[model samples]
Target chain A: MKATNLSTPKFCSALQILGLALMVFWFAAPVLQAAETLKLSARLVWGTNRDKSADDELKAMTPKLKSKFVNIFKWKEYYEISKKTFQFPKHEGKQIRMSKNCEIIMKLLDKDTLQVQVIGEDQLQRTVKHPLKPILTDGDLFVVGGDDKDSYGDAWFLVITHPNLGKEHKKEE
Target chain B: MNEKLVIQIQAYLDGELSAEARLQLLARLEKDSEARELCDSLKAEQSLLKDVGEKDHELPVAHSYFWKAISDEILPHPSPRNQTRHKQTAGAFQRWSAWLVPGGVIACIALVVFQKGLLDDVLDGIKSTGKKAARRAPSFHEIDSQQQNAGFISFRSESEGVSVVWISNY
Candidate 1:
């Protein structure tokens, strides 16, 4: 082999070509790898909802939370612990971390029957006699038909026999 | 015509009568003009009844191709133009928005300037009234609870609640 000197024009061209090749390789490698295997993730706060999608409903959730996390956080994400089952990360408290997701899809189902009633604004009772009484007071929801005053101009509420939703909720207009 | 024959003629037209009644009505139709007219009217009515129940109608097509056809015909022409116009309109709106913040601040400042004199007069009146009240007001100190119970109580002569017990004239 003929030994070429370092100052040769051919040596400079070869070095320039090698540098360009390395630049192109590293630039295109990441793009190709990203297209091949993508790792999708979203950021979530410590204890709140994500976007407006209702797919994230937390129900039967009885996680003992610390005061700093439960009150101050604006969002929360979740991850799967097992197959189709998941829990919030136990980082500082029992709340989820921001690494998994900002939203947790916890679908809730009512096991028992729900009874709804309306409370009348007027003091007098109605003429039509119902067999069962209402469970709630005036302007309250009845799970099994409470003592709701059935008359016009009275606000009504929803009552569920389910333990997850035992409290009275304002009915949407 | 006899009443029994009239009843037979009615029953024959209604298909309730025997062959004798039908034969009798046919013979009467040959002779009686009114009987023939009634048969012609009854046949017309039966034909009309068959047509009454039927309507030349059709069910609505699934998914309503009306909107789809309209979309296919009208959408491509306007969609890109609509997007362009939307962006243009948004640009115009953003340009207008640049003026809005300054305009709102100017309006708020103008409103405050307009109401400033009235608010200042009210505040000035309140201050003068406070000064007048301070000057006209009494400087009496409230006696301690235990001290008041131990001694005879006194009220100013202008007091509304009780008569004065420590008047100099007394």
Candidate 2:
């Protein structure tokens, strides 16, 4: 056989292979899925382009939950002082409630460097200090955060950590 | 009176003078009219600090009875200093550090966010942002009875500089 004999796959053979591939894809799907323990679900949106308006771009990214990050900060120097203190607005955002043994963690993309993990016990008791970078983990989901390494850079992420179970209170005798 | 001598009289008024120093100062005070005036001025400052304390002793109470009752019940039993410290790690400044436990966390996280470059500026910025609940699932494998299974998943950040692993439990 000449080297040129292997050109395009034969149409009948390709059709047979395509059918097999689809079957394989479907079969491998769930087993592959079981391997995933965490899901970071969110969207990014952008407003108009240089030529387009910011409003127009955001509208295009509609409903996806993602957006172009607008960083307008530029100054001669970083915060001139150390020990600067700032307060964040408390979030009364949706309280993601779940059954016992299920924790919900929400990381804020703009507010913090450390992920905040709050355990969701029955009454929110019990302090377990494992020192695992304050990550929130459930049997099914995980949420974590890290800080920007650039010196005095303004990137931040807020990670919310919650335990699956609440601390049990000691009953009074 | 000389300024130095006036200062000496001020120290004497505060009871910071020794016996010989007091005797010497007293002699000068008796001889100099200006020394006597300086002593009167020093006495006024001492009297002022004392009066300030008396005034502070009468501040209005801040807590109402009802609020106190709620606080007593809600706040956990903070054991005595000795017993409380017996449980936590020990150091001379441990007590003071306790006050910082909550506030320290707030700062560490806030600083990291600022450091991570999560904030990219316009034009030369990441066009999109948001976590992709990466929907890739695994293929199922036939297992023998009572056999354990294991698998791994990998992920990368937008910069692609950092990667993480999600390991399955079984």
Candidate 3:
């Protein structure tokens, strides 16, 4: 027996619906672009470099740090402690809170550079224009006690900015 | 005569009437000239039908062959050229469909692969993460918390656009 003509309209209607959906998606794609971001990790270590002269305070914190190193301080070495990870805005500028009464204002200078301004606990501020290199740049800031002596320790910073870090971090979780 | 009486006459001629009905019908035929005429006409009609039906006439075949006969009668002539053309069209359609089914499927898969930008995304992810993983182990910055204080101004990943800054005595 010859087949009747029945499926033509249904097939055409399906095509029309798909075409309409494509048109809608094409028009709305740009407005749905995802927000871009960056991840930053700051590690503060209070320890005498094995090569440097041992300070009294660093010598005291060394044994305690080594005892709690693996659990509390995953990174090795004496007097090396504390780590903070934060996300920064990719498109504009914002002051990221680091600790009590201390915040760093960061401005995205471009795709590869950042204008970083650090405000210390004493209300003193310093700014550094740094590139997003994988290597470390030291002496970004120095924290001195109330006594203010040559015994004051200097801090070094290593900053890495990668586009996939946030995504990789999220994938790990 | 009325339709009911005519029907009764037909039934009687067919020998379908009961004995009581036959008696009542015979009485009606005796008293009514119209009823008698109808009965005679019906009887003559039935006899003529029987004579005509029995005289060397062919009996009709059952209706089981009716649709087949109608189909043969109305169908177009089976021209060899037309048959070959139909077969060729069907064969071409089958061959094309054999290729087109898988071809269409492969085309759809290719479109989906490209549409989602899967290859580029994967390559870019590997490239960026690979760069990071290939880099050297990070050097540790040691500060004496008791002798000197440490403060974070800001830390940011330029590519990722994230940062953290904090001040710590230790």
Q: Model 2: runs farther than 4 Å from truth?
A: A1-173, B52-68, B71-170
Q: Model 2 over residues A81-112: C-alpha lDDT tens digits?
A: 11111222223222233323323333242222
For candidate 1, write residues B1-170 as lDDT tens digits: 56766666567656898788677678878998876776677778877887889678898876748666655675445578777987787677667656655565565555444433345445545765554332222223122221222342333222111111121110
Higher-ranked by lDDT: 2 or 3: 3
lDDT of 1 by residue, A24-139 (tens): 65577556433432111111211223332466443312232112123322224222211121222212111112222121121111111111111222211111111111111111
lDDT for each residue of candidate 2 in B1-170, tens digit (9 for 90 to 100): 46789678778877899999999989988999977987887788888888777333666666676676776687667569855675454443445454555455555455444444344322223442422322212112111112234343444333221222322321
Task: Give the C-alpha lDDT of model 2.
Answer: 0.36
The regions of model 3 sitting more than 4 angstroms off are: A1-9, A36-40, A45-47, A50-82, A88-90, A99-102, A106-153, A158-173, B1-121, B124-170
lDDT of each: 0.34, 0.36, 0.50
* Predicted structure with the largest DockQ when compared to the true one: 3
Candidate 3 lDDT over A66-159, as tens digits, reads 3433233223444423345667556757766655555666666654455666565745355555544342222122122121122344333323
Give residue A106's lDDT in candidate 2 (0 to 100): 33
Candidate 1 chain B, poorest ten consecutive residues by summed lDDT = B161-170
DockQ values per model: 0.00, 0.00, 0.03
